[model samples]
Target: MRAAVFTALCISLSAGAHVLLSANPLPLGMLAALSAGVFAVAFLLAGRRERGYWSIAALLVPLELAADTVFTTGQHTCYGQSGGPVAGSMRSLGLDLLCSGEFGTPLARMTARGEALAGTAASPWLLLGAHVGVGLVAAAWLRRGEAALAGLLRAAAAVAFRPLLLAVAIVTVAPVRSTGRPGRRSDRTRAARPRPHLLHSVLRRGPPCPAAA
Candidate 1:
């Protein structure tokens, strides 16, 4: 429960930040804008793991609205003319709610064309489906991806230790080739060579021993 609350708070803050930064006239880079969605999904997965597909389905709308509200608050957005005064400058629940009819958002405009909610034209229902579908797909994909992730980790470990393994193999084989065989042969030859005769040495000194008899 605490994990889920923390995840939700983080997701909301990130989403709000994205909204606030996107309104800046200066280009803030793509990651600054899209990072919220990426982080939100990551937090969702971390909080729920393989369970709670329903939570994702349920939270998508509220999250979107919350982000939209962040964008709308204190924002001055014009409808059509660029140089004209801002049309919807008052406090709003974002463009999705405040701007409509002639000043509608793209989705609202598309929906106003009598296009079916489930048709090729974009609508809230289509957006909802896409959002939920992506979340569900991500959950399913990650659930089944454990083996692949483990294999990748194993492969990385093997690559990291490859040089060490090569060094070990070289150490094991090099001594035998360079010195091992020659040292054994030298020992055998040294053992095989005849030693000086002990009897000959004694005989050379024996003439002095006969006087003792």
Candidate 2:
């Protein structure tokens, strides 16, 4: 379940990036709302006891890709572009590759010159390859049983160690001393109480002396 949720989250982030890079970008508010919705669903799935929610990941991947493809194609068309949907999608994919350093200067030049049609035609295959590669890596990581919430928390803590340390320092420097002072008065009262005289009690409780008997 954790693995599935993680995969969905990764795909969602990739889709969000695609939206941001598209020629007609979505408003930041809309993107934020969409992301919040996705995350809320993912959070619910993560907390579920049953594994049925894992199936949603299977649906999210294709949905995300298709949405990105459609959005990119629409943006290109709306901008009075010369290329078709395939070319537009290809350019988007190329841009992604360029940003990620998977594609070199040649592809970047082609995209820059609006000559990315040929490359775009070949991009679907490349996109599939990239997805497969990422999936394999995620699978390997998940197979190690390292996809739990605890692992996520540890990763977050590791990444935010400096801030966490600062927070700890702040709390330590300004410790909240208890105002009620719970054990102090109790301790003084107990100390002031007179203890029983052991010897006196023993003699008083002793059986009548033999001489008195």
Best by TM-score: 2
lDDT of each: 0.43, 0.48
| Local accuracy of candidate 1 as per-residue lDDT tens digits, 36-154 | 56455546555423334455434544554444444333233422223232344432534323332221223233334333332344544444454444445544443345446556878
Each prediction's total of clashing residue pairs, residues at least 3 apart in sequence or on different chains, is 0, 0
**Against the hidden reference, what TM-scores do the models get?**
0.31, 0.35
List runs of model 2 lying over 4 Å from the truth.
Answer: 1-30, 50-60, 70-74, 77-119, 139-213
Model 1 lDDT, residue 129, Cα? 51
Indicate the residue-level lDDT of 125 in model 1: 45
Residue pairs with clashing backbones, model 1: none
- Pick out the ten consecutive residues of candidate 1 with the lowest summed lDDT: 22-31
Model 2: which ten-residue window has the lowest total lDDT?
96-105
The C-alpha local distance difference test score for the whole of candidate 1 amounts to 0.43
